[model samples]
Target: MWWQAAGILLGAVLGAEVLGRAAGWGALGAGSREGHRVAVTFDDGPSERTPALLAVLARHAVKATFFVTAPASERYPALLRALGVAGHQVEAHGRWHRHALLLSPWREWAQVRWHPRAGGAGPHLYRPPYGGHSPLTRLFARLNRRQIALWDVEGRDWTAEQATTLAARTLERTEPGSVILLHDGPGVTPALLDALLTGLRDRGLEAVTLNDLPTRRITFWAGLWRLASSYGA
Candidate 1:
């Protein structure tokens, strides 16, 4: 009986882990039919260094997605325009870089509503600050007809880590339909981007924007289930 109880507990833990991983993959749109593609997305932009980053992307002929805050888009409207002109996708990253968990439904709704118009034009792809979604985030997403986006791979370039380390981490986690998260701040220099892009090319992985991802929208009930399971976990 004791052994049986232990087995049941282990099975429950394993089930939870599996469910979490599955939900994460679904959140990242990993079930995409698009083959051998990765959406390269940057958050907390468009900063002063964004021009340099944009230049690097241009050189590599890679189009990325930028989830920019309302203030950043307002402060650097020209930069936002430049991103759109350069063939990159611009989406919402909140009014500020504040966490969704800290905001009320009205505040979150305001952020989503205001950010899209801040950038002249863009698809409705919303990535929450700190990657943790709350009830408000979900509500806003549903109300605004936006898709919640998450990354399957991250370079952690914001930590001021070495380019080699960041590139290694990105490459290690990359797979078909992977969404890679990068930053356009001082922490991610042009040289580091060069290294990362070069590595991706070597691996024969093409970088794209979220707009290029295969259509796999989660239903309302499914989305709620995932959010609940994530919080419960």
Candidate 2:
């Protein structure tokens, strides 16, 4: 009896922690178990290398979701605007792309609002920087009806050796709805982006935005938006 109780306690703690770190109560980070679809999201973005990435995506004629910080979008409104015009989804990563879980709801709202002004906004999605959030995160997410997304696969494209090895590995490991992660940040220079873009295409997989994954239904977080809207009326 004691062991069973302990096990339950441990499970609950870990569950909350997972939700805390990933920005929502996401049991699976970025893949769909049902239809074998995948969504690719770009974080900390709209950087200098971002355009190169966008070009590669354009060449392939693929759309992707870019979760950028308020500052980044603010600085690069064109990048934000262009993404929208190109039929891509733009979401809120954070204000400075910082750990926003600790922020109050008002602060959180301010950060989210910043992105539209900085870059642009269509569907509002939030991904906490570095994948950690505070208790306040869930409350704000609920009130705002924002879906929080996290990645399941980390290609570790931040390091030199890791980038090359992980990029290939990511493709090999990907399933239909898997959210595979790659950094187009400083470490992943133009060459890396080209290789990754080509790699994804060659593997018989198409690059898609977070919303583009062939999902019949979005997650509970996303579903809440419609739920609340209907209730309010």
Candidate 3:
């Protein structure tokens, strides 16, 4: 039984690694830094809240990565430009936050690959809507050469009826390499960024931009998304 359990664990790890390489679903590994380093990632955004969040980040002198939807970015293209100027990393979060669990890898690749908002090529990273995961999804990401990043901490900002309480608790529980999840959708305003940014500062954590780290050069899948850098477009 113990051997079986070990085998499963090993398989999952190896499988994820192989799938990540094969599908381009991995990220820069050296990102884990000294001190309590952590990453803040927002999803489904470039919304009205995005501007507010940008201001807060600027004031606090911090940066956070945004995994934005194509349409939302298209709707607020200027905000996308601001995010870039602020030195934040822009990543792909699918065309919209729709479900595609049963989607084939190729279709998933094309959906994100061709998004005009994404500036043509898919990003090196992708976080599925609602944390959705599957082998096909992984495969597609690998084929596109993107990473399927899962989070370590989530503020549940979408359920922000009482965001303050949740945000505070999240800070108290975070550790190094923690990926904090936020939202920039309709109800998820940039107003919520204050608490999160404050929490990070109080704890003496440095927020990082993807550009701060060297790009993971998995040449086996490098050129898959040539335009992943069309972040501001």
Instruction: Score each candidate by Cα lDDT.
Output: 0.72, 0.63, 0.64
- Rank ordering of all candidates by TM-score, starting from the highest: 1, 2, 3
Cα TM-score per model:
0.78, 0.72, 0.70
lDDT of 2 by residue, 112-212 (tens): 44545334444456777776565466556656666666665566677766445656776776766667665546656445556666787676667677766
TM-score of model 2 (CA atoms): 0.72
Between 2 and 3, whose TM-score is larger?
2
Q: Give the Å shift of residue 232 in candidate 1.
A: 16
Which candidate leads the pack in lDDT? 1
lDDT of 3: 0.64
**Cα misplacement distance, residue 99 of candidate 1 (Å):** 0.7
Superposition error at 108 for model 1 (Å): 1.3
Residue pairs clashing, model 2:
36-176, 36-177, 37-176, 37-177, 38-176, 38-177, 73-118, 74-118
State the lDDT of candidate 1 residue by residue for 1-233, as single tens digits. Answer: 99999998677545433332335333445435348677778888899989999989999999988989888888999999999899888888888687655677678787666564544544577777767555345556767776677765677787868888878877887777777777767655666778888988898878788877653555455555555655675
Q: Which lDDT tens digits does candidate 3 get at residues 47-161?
A: 8777777877888887888888888878889888888788788887887576554456566666545332344444567767765544456557666666665554677776746
166 in model 3: Cα distance from truth in Å? 1.6
> Ranking by lDDT, best first?
1, 3, 2
